[model samples]
Target: MDMKKYEVGESILFDIGQKILEAHWQDLLANTSLRFEKVLDVVTVHQQKQGIQNVRPKNLAPKAQQAYFQTGAGQTQHLITDFFTDSTKIYQQLKALDSILVRNLGPEQIIWPFSNRPQDLLADEPSVPPNEAAQLGVRLVLSDELLTQLFTTETAKQYPSFAAFKNAIYLHLAQNIISNLDILVYFFGAAPIAMPEASGVKRSAIQAKRFLNCNMFQDFDSYLLSLRKAASEPQPKLLQAPLFLRPQKGDLDYRQGVQYLDLQVLDIQPNVADGVFDYQVQFLKLFLLFNVVHTTDPEKLTTAAQRFYQVANEDPTQPSQARPRVTAYLQEMREFATKFFPKTDYQTALDKMTQVVANETQAPTAQLALEFAQSGLFQFGQQLAAKNQRILTGEPYQLRGYTDKSLEIQQFIGSAIELGLNYRFLDGTGEFLQLRSQQQSAIINARITAKNPLILQAILADQQAMNNLLGFAQVAVPKGFVATDLTVAKSLFHAEFEKSGVVIAPQNGPKTAQQVFTTPIDEHTFTTSFLEALDYDDTVVVKAFIPGSVYDFYILDQRILAILEQVPVNVVGDGQSDIESLIDQKNDDDRRGRLGQRPLVTIPKTAATAAFLAQHQQNYQTIPDRGEQVFLSAIADLAAGGDSFDVYEEVDQSYQKLVLRIAQTLNMQQGHVAMIIPNIYAPYQPQPNSAIVTDVAAAVSIIPYSFPFAGNQRKLSQVIIQSLFSNSAKERADD
Candidate 1:
């Protein structure tokens, strides 16, 4: 488990079963009992035996016009349940099924499809009795009376009476089903066609909606009461519900809760090749986990279901058609998978699904749809089945570990290890490490002993002193005056404002910029912020507010190692959600986790956030129009939740030269320089510039230079270590 050696797109294998229909060319295979076997943790289909009795005409007919499928007398129809240990095994089983079908019924009789839509030939079939059709569709042959008797006997063992246990079971199932019905429908809804007059309903409904109605029951007792009422009432609404979890001899049972979920909503399409893809399996697991952790009122379930249906029914080939909420949910699921299956290639599957949702033409679904459109469905299925068969016996998948840290640190560590550099922990906590080469060993957290301690101390103790040192050396620095009191600070702010907009910051403190004000000088606001800065430090500095993006460059002696551009935290409104909701959504991103665990820090709901909102004449309840951008904070400090995008490659030569001159003037071996530039790519240099310098020891946070929010990441720590080795070698040569 060295996480450094782990691959990015790897995931663990799991054993799960997915339902699919058995077909020979265009004909369904009926009454087939599939047997499974396990050998060394790998499960496969051992045998497929035909049932002793054939499906009667009464059993094959549809109970209602909206039923999933309808068949004539003696028509063979069966659903295949494929059990697999992983995606590769699922592919193998699908290939085996294809071969078996082709061998038994000839190539012309072998049809591979993913949807469960009924055939057009069965449209004129006779109507079967509701009870008989229910039994046949789910293969639940046991009578309700017999099932009740058995379940009651089992329930009496665990409770005072069978009634109590049955109620509890119904309650559990009802809550889970009601809360998750919307997502379930979205995932499995495939039937989109229906006869209007026969069902007294116009258009088609999702497969899940074909049978189950949300208006049926309020709780466990009500569900049981409804069943009794349905048995006596002719043409009861409950008779047409899609899901069947009643007392039965099949997947579901009252005594056993839900042993299996029979989803009739899944549509059979040729593009899926096999029954489903690897991402579908991953999504199902995450979807179940999410349902278990979150709960919603049953009243809101219908609205959620309708929203999901609208999105699901849209042409997935268009990215713009995809709802933002659904896309956000998918991203959250991917993050959840990374936590649960850290050693698996689950992220790769999720990434592919994301691309599919985003309407990438290269995705499997879109690509297959194109092939189907170009060469017809049957030909596309045949070619895809052949291709799938070829890949069935490929190499077995190996799981690898996943790292949760920012990508830059991972790359730096990987590169360091590749270079054969030996590193040892400098502290027991493992925060500090000493990296060693033959010529020198560099301390990661303490890289400033090479510079004079007194000079570094003087500069860090006062911002004005540092500005004067840089200014005396003819290097550009912001013109500013210090005030020891609020009255003096206000006077200085007004004076600065007369010249231009003023910026107010604590003169002597670790995080002076955290509460800094970058607004036009006003008596009330300036006095307020000035007083706030005094709470942290004794003095405050008032200067002109520079308008540009802040850039931070790391310097080892005189050489620039890396540079980053600071981007303030902001949110884009979609018009549908309010500002508070948008902020919540942005904070929900995995990259914005607490501490330095992720690249970007989480946006905090603080007084500053409210103040920023008030300054813009807006509040948390305000609904910004679509495409509107709102800033959440004034200062662009990563510590205060601002984002940093790398600008190392885009740094102009003049900026680089300015950084080197600042480093040389400071007389430090290693340090950092912060500057403001109009354009990162532009060649213009700062004049009477607003910038600050931090000698290596005083620089508390240089990690931002390496792990920026956007642009190409730089291996800054590795660069620093390499510079140490180079400096040591040069010193030896001079000696």
Candidate 2:
């Protein structure tokens, strides 16, 4: 395993280095307080020693800069912890190897070392002292280009052979350290010696022991070694999710970018059977000798661990053969761990995952509520509870059959409890929520509407009856009619299109109390025939296609609460990547979550999306100019990866007044009204032909306003609370 005895090609070794670099970035993003400053300090010292000059550092974003210097001045003492212990020759040799890397690779090859300087760059300043340099760490940036330049023919020739070049760069990188060393050693030669003092992991090991409550171990490496050994044994038990608590000395890590850190499950690739590491690492599943919980609550830890084991036990014996099942088990464990962790922030990451999963697995209303929970509304409710001397009783629990596979109903109950209201299940079936305060009460049905005794009468009205009501109210809605026969629907659609110069389309589903003309026209069959493919039997309402952006306005009583502008799923061209590549990159965003999990939905490639692209004379292969926005779907639905913006402040007051007028005309004291407006922010102008009301829901979601994809955050929760508790006398006076 020694350096001289190992053999690896130069290019392969360079590839290994690149993988290590990629791993470093992942680790940096996952656990920002992993002592990356040590890496930066080592890089700076070597660069200075090599006399590399006339270069300037890239001005990293403020948050990124904080990540590099998170450890602060005190933690850097480990750099020279045992300066006297090392033989001068060993130190000089390590330094020399690192210096050679800098000299040969040069500034162009090392991105983090030095970016291009401006013309007015000042002369070189005196170097900081070794200790001071460790405190003021530099950025640790490594990219694909950096490694490519290292393996160039000219650079490789600088050494005696390719082996010499490989050894130098790998050894240099080892001193600075990169994540997932097993991958590195699998491709590169012998693993570099563990310079504990230089890496500061020796000190970190002691702190980690106490933080993880594993004081019996000498350091982090020993603890990991113990876990690794357990993982290999027969009848091994799954361990509780572990934590990587950085030695922050009671303060939060600045690298977190936020005031607190959520319980993070770092995806650091585990060590292979033969690879060795002398420091802490991360993995999804853990196998341990004894019960060890990574949180303040042991009960929660045990529960999550037991759940993980249940899945594992149910899984087919060989996880390697049951890859999907194993992935499911791991995800199950992660969800429990992430959700159960005590929250110091407004909403934990699990909420985002829950919404994403709900969108994939549950009803539309449940998805809307869970997504809305990710906003400050949930936190606001909790804060309100704290203020009112009410304690949050428990975590979200699911209601079977009604909100099955989703936490929306549980969220509503939680919010009600937090608001100091008493709640009772109307019946054993748990289909309704009866939330009451001393002053007032309301009974909410499964879909969020206030339950009314006459609701059955309203529900019995079909599409034509509803349209007649709207017509009587004189609302300017899309013009079309319902037809039972496919041929008649198509003929009517064609006639409407010819008259208005717009296509009339049938909706893809059974009509709801409120339906919108948001779905694109199915040009394939020119009717609601797409639904027939899904075996749908109900008649659909055909409406003239209204061309413009979709705007949703939520109104309560006389006040316009919030307006949301929904944008179709689209990607802006980056000049380099084709449409397909750009989509892949966008989907790769961490916020996109695993498919079926989300802060944002993962964009899907469907036949509809393809058809939409074909209509625009574009396909996945097309590479548009930079900044061009290419729409993938004509439908602006969030569930389909469309984006929403909080446009309450941006909407013109005249438009707000107009929406309110329509709401009043419909006798909608509380409802969501959607309109087709060319520009939501433009001054309102009378365009009876162009602007039309598309949809109206008596009960609508608060998600788009609270957890929008873009634009300013709005507090729809507050609006709801106010509406619910507003004084009857004052409301009457205002009206």
Candidate 3:
């Protein structure tokens, strides 16, 4: 098979294990600190006294396999199979390993119940030597053969010799590993605490640095030399490198090529029976692929690795203090993965990583610690084990969805179905769906597919008629006339200047601020904006610029379903971090990304931001005083990096009645009404003496209204469905 056609390589090896307490099933080993010596004794004896064969209990059934072994520490480490290629197989292997462990040790001996952190195990334990405590976590070893094949296939023609190809591959892999070690730790680091205190090493949520030495070799030769030296010259302790090029032999001369990349940084999540998830495997594959293609300086790679390690250990969920190069590298990697793989599973994994990076509270270790802070370690461990077991057995514990969109959509569908409404997909694409009852029916994404000529004509040609109808109803609209010529727009701006600031926008189409302006209007500015607007529409509506907040009210059958207040993208400063750091932190939010899956857009450091900074006499490095809020841009649309807050509950009840009246006047049973309000919370009141209805859309982007960053989450779709059902019931009652 062509390598290019297959994005994912085959048969990556996984060496995952569980660390269990040595006490009996009934023994409540409440304090890991006090029980460390006993645990160590059990593991030491298991390793020294019992050989692999003798370790298996004699009374165990033949079907029950024994994969458990003792690490240097007393904890039991089960070497689950090395033949994992995908999630399903890895899950099967984990299940098998779990069955064996349960048969032998029972379930309660496992240490981490809800987390992958080693701190839970060693927290109260006496400080053991570092070497003795090594290898207690899970390791993922990628196949050298597969990696070599990938490298040669992609760049074989460029490099003639096999040694050159191998060397290049080694260098690339080294760079990739070094650069991503911090990220690896973020996802897998479990040792947050060290027993008794290791000076200079603080208690971190990520403990990979404790055992895994992150020293990177300059080349393959140096890597092999270090390994050979470690084997030959007796070191006082075992080498603690988390990542290294495993050699095929004991000597350097016999080392033909690198054997495998041993990745020992991943923490075994206590509740996950398999230490790894399928999505994680997909991410790793993409990570490797990205590194192979993108080259970087070794020094930069090292710096990034160190920086990431620090950030991941401290708080992997937030924006790091790493340099722009390091941050860009991660963003590039994620983009590359999402682009090449393009699988829902891969996207889901990426989403999870985003969530982790955005919200520190989402980390399993943080959650477990918070939940079990007062509970004994043993009880915490037990609860975690039970939770993991439940997950492994396919018992639903927490409600998880692919993304926020899917989660909200699922809720809508579930609610609609419960109300005796029939729902069906209008197309195979699943994007368009219909809800029906005996007397009424409503279509979502109601587009002209099998077009009715009248509907098409109304949408494409009757915008002027809609405006005239709104005008006839005595509705408050922008006080301006439509201009067919740029010269006319200039005159209108001058005529309206004394009364209100003039605004120029396309009359019958969507227009961005680039082609729309609110002024301090001059003839030149008016002409430029009017000409741009004319390109989109024959006529331009030059109106009075009403200074107010933009409020969007979703209307369903003359009833107001939801209201949202649009606020331009801005950041509140802490006394510590600079403006740039805060912006980076805000953009790191999972809700701000390249995909429109989020509500708020990413505030890029564009020319607009620079201008704003300059106007405020602030640079990226400027540390704002505590409680100072800085606006990033003037644009206040969600697409323009603005955020929306739900104001339905806060806004006066009279605003809902007013919006309903407006919707009824327009005869728009299902549409959105956007108006300018001086205060969003007090929508019925206007400070500028007049409020203007800016625009109306038959179809609107409902996402912002449904999932506003602040205030109550409104189920507009569900409300629409409910209204249809209600209308149907009312019609039946009349009959």
* Highest lDDT model number: 3
- State the lDDT of candidate 1 residue by residue for 498-609, as single tens digits: 5466666676654524454565546886788778777777878766666677788777767787787876777789988888898888888656765545557787877778
The reply for model 3, stretches above 4 Å from the true place, is 1-425, 435-442, 446-468, 497-500, 508-518, 534-539, 575-578, 612-623, 679-690, 728-735
Between prediction 1 and prediction 2, the one with superior TM-score is 1
lDDT of 3: 0.51
For candidate 3, write residues 168-189 as lDDT tens digits. 4545566667667666655554
Of the candidates shown, which would achieve the greatest TM-score relative to the real structure?
Answer: 3
Residue 474 in candidate 1 has what lDDT? 70
- The worst-scoring run of ten residues by lDDT in candidate 2 lies at 284-293
- Local accuracy by lDDT, each model: 0.48, 0.41, 0.51
Ranking by TM-score: 3, 1, 2
How displaced is residue 276 in candidate 3, in Å?
A: 15
Candidate 2 local lDDT, 1-735, one digit each (tens) = 111322223334434323434434322222212111122211222322232222223221122222111222322211111111112222322222222223222233331211111110112442221212111111121222433445464435555444344334433332112112111111111111112222111111111111222321322233335545656978543232222222224332212111111121111111111011111122211101001111122123334333332322221111222234333533643543443322322123334333433343232212222332354222322232233211111111221112331233444543443354555567665547676666566665534644212442352235566556666766577777776676776677666643442333233343311123334444454544524523443455656667778888877766887788888889999898999998888788544642222436789887767777887899989998999999887667766777888878787888788878876665666767788887665777665754577776765555456557888656554345435555543555688
RMSD of 2: 24.7
